[model samples]
Target: LDRLFARHEALRSVFVAPQAKPRVEILPPDAGLPVSEHDLRQRADTEAALSDLCHEEERTPFDLARGPLIRGRLVRMSDEEHVFLLTQHHIISDGWSMGVLVRELGSLYRAFVAGQDDPLPPLAVQYPDYAAWQRQWLSGERLQKQAQYWREALSGVPSMLALPTDRARPAQQSFAGASVPVVIDVDLTRDLKRRSRQHGTTLFMTVLAAWAAVLSRLSGQNDLVIGVPSANRGRREIEELIGFFVNTLALRVDLSGEPSVSELLERTRRTTLAAQEHQDLPFEQVVEIVRPPRALDHTPLFQVMLAWENHAGPSFDLPGLSVEAADGLDQVK
Candidate 1:
């Protein structure tokens, strides 16, 4: 516990600053920034944003003690357009915390553009608070129940995911991959929502089931495994807080054709609810619970991802400000 906190700033900080949102003043997009000058390609825009954010803030002795930790950046891309990109360490921000970060950034940006003060609320809690709560909750009899379910559910399941990889396994550990992109149309997306409503399950569960069916068809295997990021935000106090309150959970789904979509959803619904109920347990602990041998060549217990959508968070407005998804931002990879 001390080691993990020592490595992550948000873990040590009692709370995130209410007004810590990063800001960039963009004159216009017409004035092009030379790629050579910045020494960055279009693809490296996100990297530059992260680097800029790290050093932009005043680094105090306390911050130095926290190590080089900064998770956000605002870059002026052009006269009219300024793009902000942030890469928070997994220790600080989880998938759920992305929404919280974006909303606050948006609110702060809009206020800055309008020459108004940002009335951002102070964080009621921090990632450490959530972590402490989780450690206390996921113990003794409660964890035993979770252990029983996991053991039964995963019994006899092979550890390998059988994903196509490029090179043979080397002694040193490293991971690399390229993915094929896929997109779901707006109308079909709406149909998915309707189907989810009909099943009395959430959109998350419904989408996850559809992916399981796809994997079943592709792999020609009855047994399926997927990794889902749990938001871990059921608690009211931490909903508005940022950082890695998110953790990935390995959810094994059976697509042997015994259960229809609705039935499968029901199973998933129960599993998801049960998982959420115990979500305070970090993925680090889960790795211990489900001890499948770790490997370099082979993918872990679960390889496929069943992502629903990106969190847009709140929006910021300049005099002529507007936000739109970049031409290919939503392209699924």
Candidate 2:
């Protein structure tokens, strides 16, 4: 864990100054993670206890200005069974960084078990270096070009999708939500893959097209805009680096004229590709460029967000343990 902290400077960094103009302050090497240990073997309902403990950790807020924004806990269920909990703030890391962290941790664990030195090479660039490069690259003419693309793309977009709701929207927005897993059977999955291949499109594009159709039905609106997240790790240097590099792209889904399925998929493919070409522009800047009417009850640009886990998932190849994800503990609210 100490080596993990040393390798990723974001683990020891904190944000300071006004919220609008926040700056990162990297702490000294002495700053470290305080991993608390717990023994749940004595408890009769060990799984329930673990779930409660993890939920408690999730609810505990981090102090962004004070110091470390990550927390770790090790729980022992039996002689050979143990669970490690890691909670981190999104300011320093994103979904892609989590995958990188887990992959590196597995490599480090295997090497250490063999009495070998750290096999991983030193990082070529830290989080701050990437931040500096981003600011430098996205400026002047380059920035204006991307901004112009968004201005034309989102021009005359609807303020929000008229998604039917049972209750009235609150005055303020909230992130409190629950995730319900919907399973698509094997036959449907296989057919979807086959169709994607037939159309020369990815599963992501096909599913996104279908999703836009569903939203069109629910909202009774044909013209829809959905927000999609991009990893934004086009540069190889930042691929393995642990930091927050995720960007959101607004995809305008046009379902006018009751287009056929194939036509809709083709349109979605074109929109996705065009957005990817100009994805370097941050979503916040895109909002500023479009100048959408803002309301406290909802977000700007697009209200409905689509986060497809289309990238590689976390890989944990530990040596001598039966590994499976624990339910409920993975949820963040």
Candidate 3:
């Protein structure tokens, strides 16, 4: 815990408001982070008790202005079974940051149990330093070049997609959504992987191509755009840092001419590569340049979002602990 606190400056960040533009104030390292413990072994229904505890924690929101944005707890279900829950605000962390945290925590725990020194090396640069460099670099000519590209690429594109929904469209849309799990059979998964390898593209691009086809068939719209989150961690210095380095890219995939699956995959691959070339341009700047027509009932540019989880938390083989990934909804809201 001490090492993690000292390593990542964003963990201690607090948002300072009341100014024209909000700024982050990184506080000094504290003694230790707050962690609660619960003993559910005494309860008659341990599974129900664990679920209630997690729901309570999820319902509790963090105060951005206050300190200790991250919270954790340890729940004991039995003498040999336990669960650890950690929560943090999205402003301070991201999917990649969570992977870093889990890997580092496992390393730190193993070292502490063995009574050894910390093995992690010093970071090349912190989050604040990256912010400073970004502000200085992304401006003037560079910003204008990327902005012009986006303007031309998204010219005359439809602002909203007509996805078929069961409920009627409301005056103002509500973000309340649900997740339905879709499982792909083993044969299909294997074939997708093989096709991706053969095409020299990623599985993500292939899946996205299929999704675009589905949307095209549903709405009868050949030209469409979908929003995707890019890791935007192009710099080697901030690759391992714990911060919000992700950016959204408006990927415009064309499915006209009744192209075959392979042809669509090729088209999607080219589109993704082109967008990735200019991904440094912030999404806000793109929105300003393109000036997509906004609607009160739906989002601008693209309503559907597709995210690819390229980073997975490291595996741990600690002495008495069985580590497994947790399942959750993948909605943006």
Best by lDDT: 2
Residue-level lDDT of model 3, residues 120-164, one tens digit each, is: 888889999999999889889987888888998889889789888
lDDT of 1 by residue, 42-148 (tens): 54465556345444532322232232333223455555555444333354556665555555556666667778875576566655666677778888998787776
**C-alpha lDDT (0 to 100) for residue 112 of candidate 1:** 71
Q: Using TM-score as the measure, name the better of candidate 1 and candidate 2.
A: 2
Window of ten residues with lowest summed lDDT in model 3: 324-333
Q: List the candidate numbers ranked by TM-score, top first.
A: 2, 3, 1
Whole-model lDDT values for every prediction: 0.59, 0.88, 0.85
Model 3 stretches astray by more than 4 angstroms: 193-200, 326-333
Candidate achieving the largest TM-score: 2
Candidate 2 structure quality by residue, lDDT tens digits, 1-333: 777887899888998888589788997766777688989989999988987888788788999998688888888988888888888899899998988888898889899998999999999999999889999999999988999999999999999999999899889989778779899899999999999998878899999999999999999999989999999999998899888899999999999999998999899999999999999998988998999999999999788888988676575787986666665556321
TM-score of 1: 0.67
